[model samples]
Target: MRLATFVAFLAISTTASPVEKRADAFGIDISSHQGSNIKWSTLKSHGISFAYVKATEGRNYVNPYFKNHYDGAKKAGLLHGPFHFARPSASSGSAQASYFISHGGSWSADGHTLPGALDLEGGCAGLTKSAMVSWIKSFSSQYHSSEKRYPVLYITTNWWKSCTGNSAAFGSSHPLWLASWASSMGPLPAGWRSAAIWQYSKETGSTPGDQDRVSGGSAALKKLALGH
Candidate 1:
């Protein structure tokens, strides 16, 4: 009787959990680490709709292959944009934001261009939770001032909670590119009820880099790019 009850409980728990649902749009993110040679047209043929290319890190270190990736994606008919890897400990947020924008992280109203993203991982760079949140705010503010829209934040829930105390400060304004390399999305951070893009896998294959799914599909993705 006890074994039967345990099995039944396991079944119920499994059924109650939300699985990762497929989205209409799939994309990939790339950096200098991914090398310069990428088959963008092949990726597009394989159903890739968008891409995020790394542009800068900290207040220096621009990705040398940014143009190669960006232009390649555009030429292949995939919407694309640049992203910045944050180095909160190395410099002020505004300084880094300015550096990023000057390098390649700027956004335009072009339909094929997506808004820049901030890669906000790496254990807060040794900042306190409050300091981290303030740094993020400063970066977001600077980006918004320059681009007229807040940058998408590429972060994991665990990192957000640990680094910023899961602050809801940007949830209402910024779109989240959630990095959860798991079968389940698990719990979201404090502010966001849903992710704009969910990075579900780190495995590379036909897509080029990490795999990501746009939450609301192509329509939502276009809206993100158009700032609508």
Candidate 2:
């Protein structure tokens, strides 16, 4: 009974409350690990406004369910896009960016399609801090050359500091999709003043995957999708 009550509370808290409904957007980031049976329409009804689907990693290894998640999110009326897992030690950033774009990371002007995101976390993959920063710049530049917009950068404060030696090169250009996972967003990486998206919890409630909070409401969400 306590577990059930706790679940009820979590559902109420994670799904947009009245105040959040008026001011912010809630979303999820998912991959094949979440399985292919997601009920996206139900999540939208529960106030999910967007979704990020894992698309590719390295120069290969596309997520098998990328299309399903992208199509399902679109059908459910959620702004949706793909994210690429960074592998700086395995391949050139430009090559990996090409692989990601050719596979499913391409962006369009469609209102519901969001620009691709770069999921850069974990260890530095043995690259020097300068190399890591250069790798990221190469990836961002390549993605922009192809898609006409820089990919959103998904990172955590500690990882950013440790891996890239707290590089601020991309902060001015790339959107920060910060993974803080706390009651509130803590200190950001150097250079960024705020995050465009915050992955607040790895847990899901009335949603299929990790929970996220958008900084601005629907207008900002639309602007992000529009690449403004």
Candidate 3:
């Protein structure tokens, strides 16, 4: 992630401060470090209707705040989704996805929780670009087999180009949460015509983490939240 790109991300996003007004259904994502005192009501009062909390990383690492954040977000009346950071080299995607599910990514028919997500950023866990694509496929396959719904894929252009060769295999089936700070989504990896959620900001003191916008507004957001 280039500094310039990250800066643009902060600018494009409306920011997490409740003072900023946004018409779309924008949300925030956080990990254990956000602390347990996050005022979820304050976010909801500001128009944040949903959130994605980090659950697990690789396979063994679990977010210390996942349970709290998840339950707290729900208590605040905000839709919640749990995300897992992918570490293809640490373990097979199948194993990692299963582990994530076992920990906190489990899907339910409840409309408040979205399907699990795979955050496939950062350096490839030591695999070739082609091998990285294979890793995602394996992970997605395992996740879908168990949940009956495709877990959302969150990624950036540089990582995708360098790791997966920008494979289009999962585009049509999996909804994408594209990470780009540019004014445009730029060129999406092959297959995906558009992104479902655009992570427009990475620097925002108001939210304590990254913030994003759901492409289809609140209605579409409801569908994703319901895992439809």
Candidate 4:
């Protein structure tokens, strides 16, 4: 995440503004399998303000790729956070919350970085709508809001509807990180407009993981994640 590398990544900038113009914000998601390594220079150069690195899963599984990326993100001076890939088959939401706390590195202890994220997708296939909402609530409630008010809720557009048909069940207070790979942010399903961070694509060049296709990369993103 070197500043020089970030500059190189920004060399191919499109017509979009360096900062986003709309209400939402943008960032990238990284995992262990992406293979490409991230450097602070890259993040700085590309104007990347924040990132979410894969942390751990269920009970025993941990993402081997998290440490370096997490370290690099912090070094680059970006607001860094970790996410857990929810495993719906093996454990209850309460159990998953316990596992996430045990394995997901200490963000509060290290620094008041961005809140933790729940990467819910196909992996969370077994839970009913009630169960899914309960799982989210169980995990989010553990983190004292006095410390970090809202933990992130990461989910796809359609999956969110099917999983939490009643968005009200999720409590409107928490901010969302919606993942929609479509060309435009339009067609964003109901109950997601409250999202503070919208992952529009996987095409980001700064972070060495999925290149998120994003709408804008403005300072607003920095404010949302870094609390500037």
Candidate 5:
């Protein structure tokens, strides 16, 4: 009877296991798929410091909510930036880079513009790992030359291993935004020494979106936003 009671008590316990929350800063990443229900001020009130809004993807697809989210973040006093989802084999790197920059990838020294990110996981469509790396390199290079800053790489260990050869080749120049559901940051990418941000969960606050923790607090993150 005691054993059964113990199990029941454990199941009903409101307290939870420990989770990693030692973040310099916390924020979310959103796209048109998440809709426009986000109230930036309310989120700010809840201590949401920044956000990354989906801009362009592939060669031509733009996030329909890009402008509103960007504006909303500003209106709500949240620092924000744009992200482009990669379709490695669908288009040439420079071509896609052009599309993304033209849409919203351009960064200004303004306080709200965090470094843009290249979301790299995708259906490769037969693109070889070597070719895919080259593609991403070309895109990031072009973005750097044009905007004077390299975009962050958002990726996972498994995807990086299979699709990117798990090499830390880009780590020196491009910071990483690693995604993991574990209670901690877990292992970073093979080449990257540390992550710029860790996407720790897919749910947070009153909004349904990916949650993240910036490595260096709000100051470092804000510097990236200002293109410093």
Candidate 6:
């Protein structure tokens, strides 16, 4: 289906309602690594406002569940975005970018859904710090432009310090989506001054899948996705 029509369908289905008094808002992230079938309808009905669906990993292979969750997220009227799982084995970041494009260039389009993300965590597996940062730069540079904003760099505090200690590598311009998973949004890591989204916990909700707890609500996430 056309992207415009798909988005319009989402808008119509996502009729805003009176904000119910609640203690907090929630979001979910699905990926191939976490093998579980998601009931998008159930999530939506249960007040899920946003979701991050894994798109691709390494230089080959898109997430098998990507399209399913992508369409499901749209159908559920959730603010949606795609994230790439950075592979330490990959030769270059541009190679990873090429892989991502081949998997889903829809993310490259301006003003569409949420900004793409780079899932940067875990051990180097073999790559050096310079190689890892080079990959990051290549990936970021691919989408870096006045017209096209670079994807948010998704990283844990320790991972950032170990992999890319240089804050200036990403500069101050790119939006950061830090994964702290702390009790509260306390003092962030050395390089990170602010975060667009704070992934607070892996244990959340009365749902089945391993979900991530976030600080913002549906409205806040929707604003981020639509750039409003």
Top candidate when judged by TM-score against the true structure: 2
Task: Report the lDDT of model 1 for residue 105.
Answer: 91
TM-score of each: 0.87, 0.92, 0.87, 0.77, 0.85, 0.76
Tell me, by lDDT, which candidate is best: 2
lDDT of each: 0.83, 0.86, 0.81, 0.63, 0.78, 0.65
Location of the lowest summed lDDT over 10 successive residues in candidate 6: 1-10
Q: Given candidate 3, what's the lDDT at residue 201? A: 66
Error of 6 at 17 (Å): 18
lDDT of 5 by residue, 71-172 (tens): 999888888889999887788888888899999988887777787899987555577788878888999988998998899899988888888677768988
Task: Rate residue 11 of model 3 by lDDT.
Answer: 48
Residue 109 CA displacement from its true place in model 4, Å: 9.1
lDDT of 2 by residue, 1-228 (tens): 122333344468755467766688888888878778777786787678899999999986999999998999999999998999988989999999999999999999988888999999878899999999999999988999999999999999999999899998888888999998778999999989989999987754543347787877888899989988
The residue pairs that clash in candidate 2, if any, are: none
Evaluate residue 207 in candidate 1 and report its C-alpha lDDT on the 0 to 100 scale: 27
* Ranked candidates, highest lDDT first: 2, 1, 3, 5, 6, 4
* Residues 1-228, model 1: lDDT tens digits: 122332343234324533522245778788877777777775665557899999999986999999998999999999998999999999999999999999989999988889999999878788999999999999989999999989999999999999999899989999999999888788999989898888987744432247788866788899999988
Worst 10 residues of 5 by lDDT: 13-22
Minimum summed lDDT over a 10-residue window in model 3 is located at 1-10
Better of 1 and 3 by lDDT: 1
TM-score (C-alpha, index-matched) for candidate 2: 0.92
Model 5 RMSD in Å is 7.4
Q: How many clashes would you count in candidate 2?
A: 0
Candidate with the larger lDDT of 4 and 6: 6
Instruction: Give per-residue CA lDDT, model 4, range 1-228, as digits (tens).
Output: 333443454554421554342422335677786544766565555656667888888667888878787888888877678888887777765566666667763346344366677778884377778777777777677643233545677777778779877466553566677776666654555655555666765544564334333234445444445543
- Candidate 4's TM-score reads 0.77
